[model samples]
Target: MVSSIAQFQIKPIGAELHLFGIDISFNNSALFMIIATILVSAFLTQSVKSSYTIPNRIQSLAEMTYEFTTKIVSENVGIEGMAYFPLIFSLFMFILAGNLLGILPYAYTFTSQIIVTFAISIAIFLGITVIAIIKHGTKFFRFFLPSGTPVYMAPLLIPIEILSYLSRPISLSVRLFANMVAGHTMMKVFGGFVISLGAAGFVPLLFLVALTAFEVLVAVLQAYVFTIITCIYLSDALYLH
Candidate 1:
């Protein structure tokens, strides 16, 4: 049987200067993130530089991405949430590229790693917390209090709210990490069956092909879900609730 758990092999590319007692070893995940960043930057710059009034292919792609993200933010958070377009759009592109790139044979899947997803989720958590505090000031604490709750229940409800708020990062990170890892593992398992069964494996092989297509759709959909959730969080922060 094929192993569903991927090996977390830590290959040391190089070690940076140690900070205090901590040594930082760069690895494949770092490399893929750098590549993803460069790809996103290049694509955006090229698309914008070749701008056309009537919209060419690259321009249309860029516009479509913008409109897609704008619609999500607008519908979920309303017009006042438009200020978050850049962050939402960047998140969507980076994640979409990372997920899609990982679909390629032998490419590293960064999103499958907990560290990467945790970093992203934590950043979103912090950004929302800061925005809430800044926009609502000390009144942000009121997010915990239910509108119709009895004044006596405030003590009980506030802690629950605090717990829920604190759990956002955990929930966000796990959702993406679990989905990416599970789908890829399933794909790998089915793919192995095709190889092992040889010519007689045509049925399983056909199913594997279909699953590949589904995984591709999932890659895009998960990216969208992550981005839209981010917008919703931002909206909650900005509008308080």
Candidate 2:
């Protein structure tokens, strides 16, 4: 019987490549990330191959995805945020692909790992902050300090706001990581039950099926939540409100 947590272990596929102290060898996590990226790229490519006045199924899906991301950015960040539509959309689709693909049997779920999600979160946070800095210059500091604040309240509120802003990536990354890990780990446990219980495992087998479907919904929803929060953060940066 395999341990439920065993599935989360990272195993290298081939030669362990350690260049300059960095373990850059290809592993299950890397393989799945590659697969997710390729899948998203291929899907979008095929989805938009034919552009017609009347929408085909593939075109419709592609168009829907485009409009969905556009709406997310437009609504949250307004017109100026449209400049980042492609960025926000790519992030959404990438995470969405990772979440969905990980649901497959025997597939590696990198998003379950905090490192992967944290890296993405950090990148997004940095990019948004950089944009704010570039666009607003010194006024970017005003983000943590609201205008018309009493001198007494400035010190108290400023530190709290700063901490909250700094914790954005941590909170954002952990939410996805925790969700994926919890859901996948539960499924693994149920799967183990089905295998070990023999004929009597039918109950758990049924549960496993339902859990798998629920994970699919979670996969999409997590992607949406992350993207929306990012949009909100971007909007705050742009508008400083």
Candidate 3:
């Protein structure tokens, strides 16, 4: 059991020196995030430097990523919001790489941690709020009052909108964190069964393999869902509908 737990747990890569009595631990998640950032930066740099009119492998990959995000933004947020392509693209790639990297053996899933997901969700929420307020000034508060809402119901509709708006971060963070943690935990449990039962555990092992593939798909899908919701939120800010 101890071995199984060890197999599933993430280990620290290094520790930061304490400053002002605040201890900061740097771990595998931090290492993987650095790796993910480097990978993204390198890929984009290489693709741009190549400048191949015919398109090579790296260029093809870069184009695909650009097209995917562009399509999503255009469809969901419209042309006016195209300026946000970089933010949406980076968010998708970062989460996608973090998720896919975590699926590797002995890798840490940062997205499974509530702290990371909450940080991301909170950032997105605040960014959209700032954009809306900057664009609309004090009038942005009018968003809480739905169009065509009866004047007498302003007392009721306002609170409902406020509650729904406040719930965004909670819902966004939980959806990603819960899915990643639950899927990885179940995979680890089944994998342990396969190891302990040895050759006789072929059935569980096969199921584990199937679950791994499914988890890979889930990781990609979750990243897409996260990015799409971001675009939707941006749309709400841009159009206020």
Q: Name the best candidate (by TM-score).
A: 2
Runs of candidate 3 exceeding 4 Å displacement:
2-10
What lDDT does the true structure give each of the candidates? 0.84, 0.93, 0.88
- For candidate 1, write residues 94-173 as lDDT tens digits: 99988887888767788989888999999999988998999999889888896788999898888999999899999988
Tens-digit per-residue lDDT, 1-241, candidate 2: 8889898999999998999999899999999999999988887887777556787887788789889999899999899999888899999998999999899988998899999999999998999899899989999999898888898999899999999999999999999999999999899899999999999999999999899999999999999999999999999889887
lDDT of 2: 0.93
lDDT of 2 at 100: 92
**Clash totals for all candidate models:** 0, 0, 0
Candidate 2: worst-modelled 10 consecutive residues by lDDT: 46-55
Model 3: weakest 10-residue lDDT segment is: 1-10
lDDT value for candidate 3? 0.88
TM-score of 3: 0.92
The TM-score ranking, best first, is: 2, 3, 1
Task: Identify the superior model by lDDT, candidate 2 or candidate 3.
Answer: 2
Candidate 2 wrongly placed segments (more than 4 Å): none
Residue-level lDDT of model 3, residues 1-241, one tens digit each, is: 5444454355766667476887656777777889899988888777767566788887888889889999999999999989998899999999998899889987888888888999999999999999999998888899999889999999999999999999998899999888898888888889888878988789999999999999999999999999999999999998898
